[model samples]
Target: MTDHPRSGAHDRLVTSLGTSIVTGELPPDSDVDPVALESQFGVSRTAVREALRVLSAKGLVGARPRRGTFVAPREQWALLDPDVLRWRFADRVDGVFLDELGEVRLTVEPTAARLAASRRTDRDLADLEDALAAMRSAGEKDADEQVTADLAFHDALLRAAHNELLLQMSVVIEVGLRLRDQFVHGALTTESADKHAEVLLAVRKQRPKAAETAMRALIEKSIADVEIAKKAI
Candidate 1:
């Protein structure tokens, strides 16, 4: 119970302030006064400092030589950190980003699906099925959870292709998922889910063109959704 309170205090301070920091409430070059944060979060300086240390480890902040702590540049941010990803989603989610994601998906994911069709191992298929099942179950869940499952499926399929070059695109895919986390749930029709299932079927059947076609349908739908969202906004 004592540890739980301490843990909860630390997490609340970090989660609230981390979003503010990364979303530019505390912009780059902005000083982070530990006392101010402690006051604002109604916690001790020790707790606030510990929260800042977590951010510092992730390269979101840096301590200057006797000056103070300041926010780090976007390039220094921990892209893979779950907090950073959420902050990014909260910070800037524009149609241009989604459009770029759709373009990349059209160019990359379909072909990866085709290659997986030809090269996937039994283990790969088993992993793919697991991810698909997870995704299906997550469809009833939040967009964030669904995107995590959806990404696992595509990432596994890419790895299944056995192409080192394709594997490098994992970061790009992760970034795309982060960008699409909201737009996907908002725009995805039930038909979109079925379309993805068709792509999986094509991959399972070892039909390259079919795999490509089905994947293109999925990306094309995403592109349309991006365009529609742009017009609405």
Candidate 2:
């Protein structure tokens, strides 16, 4: 598939605008004048319009027939969008945001684990095992590797559930996992590895109840760690 001719300009504008809104530089409800943006970014009006269209889709901005485009309210922002999530995490880790994200994981991940326990194939199990092995080898000392492996483990679990809708959530889950690990240092290490082991064993044994419980415990611990880190920050 060929890339859009203006995709580069569109993406740059999106990132610039998204970061501004997320960082409060473009305050909520403030007008986002396309003409002004075009001049500032040195992009054409077409590129600016395309960028605003993308941002609107992501819930970062809103447009109306009479009123011009403007930054959306925080409640209206698509927190699940990976780009939006990353922008939020870029400046600081908001405790309320972390709690909201935790609530989402608490609602989704345990159920996914339960489903995976019943639906996972041999290949799925192998993927989970590979991620776990990577995690173990990376250990606490290698934070970046640990985060990547940890994300891989969760991604494998979500796919193992064999649900398209749940699988679609991989990006949001990935963003949350990455931000948590990156900002909340010392949260995922031997302790998290052990918890993941419980989940892996449960899935391996095809114990849906155990898998659900293990995942719940793991997420709960992560939420606690996030809270602790929030206090520290």
Candidate 3:
């Protein structure tokens, strides 16, 4: 646990450094000057050290016996950690990263949708409908709201699956989905509500095959949408 009194400073320092490392502002294997960090972030030495500890736990940095702490290789990063994923999505839109995220979604979501259709409870259905309603209400007029609602719909879908492992995986998946949604927000030429509705309809009807198919199509559209958005960027 961190010092309660210095929590704010600790958090700020961690955020700044984490974002820099993930965005390549502080590229892999670069030296990390803790004394410089204390000066730059205007935090106590203790706060700086504590922040470094947090990043270390996230696999963002490591110390050499003679050389002090340095940014770790990119492959060493805890990519599934929510904070790391958030930092990666904080700035810069990389098409390759988005494609990889889509591939992950393809691997996870269709199977989740199939299970949800087979096992969803009344409460799960209610939550999904509520999320879908919010999505419809937001439409294209409100990009931020649409993104939030879209995320909620997926979260509810995962919950509907009623599997502990998939639920755990949703933590990472949600972050990637938000990035994709935000990236394609204003650039999307087609209405996404209908596609989401198709998946919802299948789940509601307890059609596993249909739900799986609809989810696959939805994810495919998202992949294509990201590609289109990248071109506009």
Candidate 4:
């Protein structure tokens, strides 16, 4: 239990460092020392080392032969690591990662919407409803709560579609959530939440074509929003 809060703080530091890397705040190929990093973050040396270890595991940072810890080049980032993904997404909302993630979402989510339209069971609809309700809770929810609700909304829709390939696409959702973790605000916007409602409405109404269209629109809008977010940098 004693380690719980400490563990969380360590994770946050790792995440913040990851954010710094992906956003170019910590430039590629730069050298880092634990003592310097510890002082910079105002954490203990052990915490700093542990956070660096976490980054190393995610392939964002590496220990050189004797040059000390160096920030990996941009190409070395483990794009699939959840931590990496969120950092990338949150790093600079206007980046190529947002555009790329949006493009992928367009390809994957509409199809998932179509499947859920045809195969979604009643319980699946209920789950979707629950997610929608959570989203409407007015005021910024916690980051984890946002991730959970965002993911739950997507997962419930995927389940409703019931295609084995669609079900297999859960990995994609996982990737998206990782991208979301870098946000200073709640993971998604009210606009995105509104679009999510449209998707849910189409699915609940059993309009497969409508659901597919709505899902597509949502993806397009999210892409636009991400572009806007990137401009803030």
**Which tens-of-lDDT digit does each residue in 153-221 have in candidate 2?**
999999999999999888888877777776688667888999999999999999999999999999999
How well does candidate 4 score on lDDT at residue 157?
A: 82
After superposition, the stretches of candidate 1 with alpha carbons farther than 4 Å from their true spots are 1-6, 91-93, 103-108, 123-186, 207-213
Assess every candidate by TM-score. 0.71, 0.91, 0.90, 0.62
**Candidate 4, 1-233: lDDT as tens digits:** 12323576687788888888877788989877788777777888778887887788777898867788999987777776656666765524334555666777888899889878887888998999898777676436566666677788888887887777767667666665555445224547677788899998888888899999999998777666566656665
Error of 1 at 206 (Å): 2.6
lDDT of 4: 0.75
* lDDT tens per residue, model 3, 1-233: 55333488788999989999999899998999999998998898888888888899899999989999999998899988989988887865567888897898899999999999999999999999998889888767787877778888999999999998888778777777667766776632236778888999999999999999999999898889898888888
Q: What is the lDDT of candidate 3?
A: 0.87
Query: Model 1 misses residue 1 by how many Å?
Result: 27
Which pairs, if any, clash in model 3? none
TM-score of 3: 0.90
Q: Which candidate wins on lDDT?
A: 2
Better of 2 and 3 by lDDT: 2
Off by over 4 Å in 4: 1-12, 39-45, 85-92, 95-97, 131-152, 159-210, 221-233
Clashing residue pairs in candidate 1 are: none
